[model samples]
Target: MPAVKVRKEEAERAKRLLKRLGLYDGRRRPKREGEWVLLPAVGGDAIGTLGYEVLPLELPLRPERQLYKNLESILAERLSEDELKHLRRYDVIGDVAVIQIPPELEHRVDDIVWGLRRVHPFLRVIARKGFHEGKFRIRDYSIIWGEERLNTVHRENGVEIAVDLSKAFFNPRMKGERYRLAQLVKDGERVLIPFAGVLPYALVIARYRRVKITAVELNRDAYELGLENVRRNERKLRGEIEFIHGDAFKVLPELPGHDRVISPTPRGVDALALTLPKAERWLHYYDFVHEDEIAAFRRRITEECRRLGRECEVRVKKVSDFKPHVFKVCADVKLG
Candidate 1:
């Protein structure tokens, strides 16, 4: 297909107008040559509407480059050396870029937003204002640039997940964790996810393994999104995924036994102890703890199983960092 070639400086404005007219093709990246950007257009009509010259060139589809490389260069003149050093990396969830602005560089957030948008023309950048809180475990975010909406469809491991940042919890950082859990699941095995936010873990596992999964969520909004996500990914799924919208503690006990269980809730390990089915199963439990406290965390899971008269072997591994001292750890426990 032909694309509209416009000056690099005017590409953002042209993209906005093209998107508004429903002529933007997201599947192809804009081809750049010298000072001009070649945007994928539905037809030559977009050239007149966007006021750009037509380029009858076929650009090879390529994966997007990292956003930070361009952002760092763009903000070089606007940010001080000390402030630039404090910039943390951001996450791209579909077309939304969720960033955390450090206190030192907070005043230059507008410049940062502009830099992000300039680098990734299609992305809507937002600044994360608060930490993940409450039972729903969702963070507060404010629009820094681009669109005002919080809802977006994020694709991960060949599955599509529809989530609203204001209503539910969806972590793009957990892509590796979801993939790791899916790889561990065996064929024909039954799996359970007690903290299945928007069915990311369940959907990823279903796409890769032929297993039956029962996902439970406490938050009503997240539960509703999970159902929608499951329906959206139905054509690509390889197994059955059932969603239960209620507290894991209450909903888990009534459910049947499963070969594997995943508890990724941020509410702590108490929920795991309360809802674990009284049968032999593999438990993938997540928690936040310091490196030195990993042993104690493992002992806590062991004690929980001991109290229930179920012999178990527990191992803990660092999944990611929660802060400078704290870490997001996973305790893999096998109960018999």
Candidate 2:
């Protein structure tokens, strides 16, 4: 076995070198033949996805132009461990760490999966999560993420939820609403939740008080997943929970009036301009769209209210800004 000797200076240089190459705290470093150390891949940031992201395999030598080419060969050669069709990489948290590969790379995810598990077989393979910004890392205490740990949780409010870190799926940042609903909901509020993904919000509300929840979801897969989650944790629920596989726009009119409704959606919210013109009920929107777009969206709601002759009370809350970019911002939105 050959020992890849590193002088004190060289090791320090390697740390900086790899850091620039998108390798961080948890990257495997070969000290000698067949011996590697998986360091702590961790960091912290107030705004961003899960704080820390894993550092996967790296090249033997720096081949910046040939990175993809090297990774391609590594995949075709079956260099990875367990097959994972869902794993992906990103430079979301760190600009240099971010790299975009085509969806076809899904076939190659196996290489990465196999590669990581061989070195750290016990770690859970959380797939398809995005990357960290410069200040953020998966190891960061505040971020609270890792494949080994489940992102979602059963809130004290009794809602069993799968945390959608991407915000494309769910935003855990909507912590304030938990308090708002607790105060507003009465003994038996008939509540409607459109586009319910896992019904995390509804579950929390149900835990706080007795309520009849009619949740509408559009995607078949998501709706089914939500049902399973609801069933698994039914004991935690205090009220009747119903799941409907229907489009909100198509079904909103058919359903009877309710005391309250929740519309928590859009990871990088654009605006509700499309729905504003026909807005009927008071709405709460919590998603990241453009700041400028909210006004136009409100106007649309005003027009819709006028036509229907309904009192449309609306509220928009900026849940959190997930990331900052040169021309755009990803944020959480709530419309009421």
> Compared with the true structure, what per-residue lDDT tens digits does model 1 show for residues 1-336?
778888999998987788668676654678788999988867656456555787776555434324565677788878888878887777788888888887888788788887777777888646555677777888888877777888899988999999899899988878888999999889998898888888899999999998998888888999999999888988899999989888877778788778888888665546766555523579898888887888888888888898888889987877877888798888888887
On TM-score, the candidate that comes out on top is 1
Task: Give candidate 1 regions above 4 Å deviation.
Answer: 1-70
Cα shift from native, residue 67, model 2 (Å) = 32
Q: What tens digits encode model 2's per-residue C-alpha lDDT throughout 1-336?
A: 111233444555545444544434322334332333323223433112323222333424322223433444455457334332333332122111223334655555445555444433344433444443221112221221244433444343446564333331443434456657656667677777776765667777776778888888776656766777678677876877888987777776677767666665444433344333222333455554466676665565566566655655545444444445121221222223
Alpha-carbon runs more than 4 Å astray in model 2: 1-123, 126-128, 131-158, 162-168, 175-179, 266-281, 322-336
Q: What is the Cα-based lDDT of residue 216 in candidate 1?
A: 88
Alpha carbon lDDT at 266, candidate 1 = 68
Q: Give the TM-score comparing model 2 with the true structure, all chains together.
A: 0.48
Every model's Cα RMSD, please?
A: 15.2, 15.8
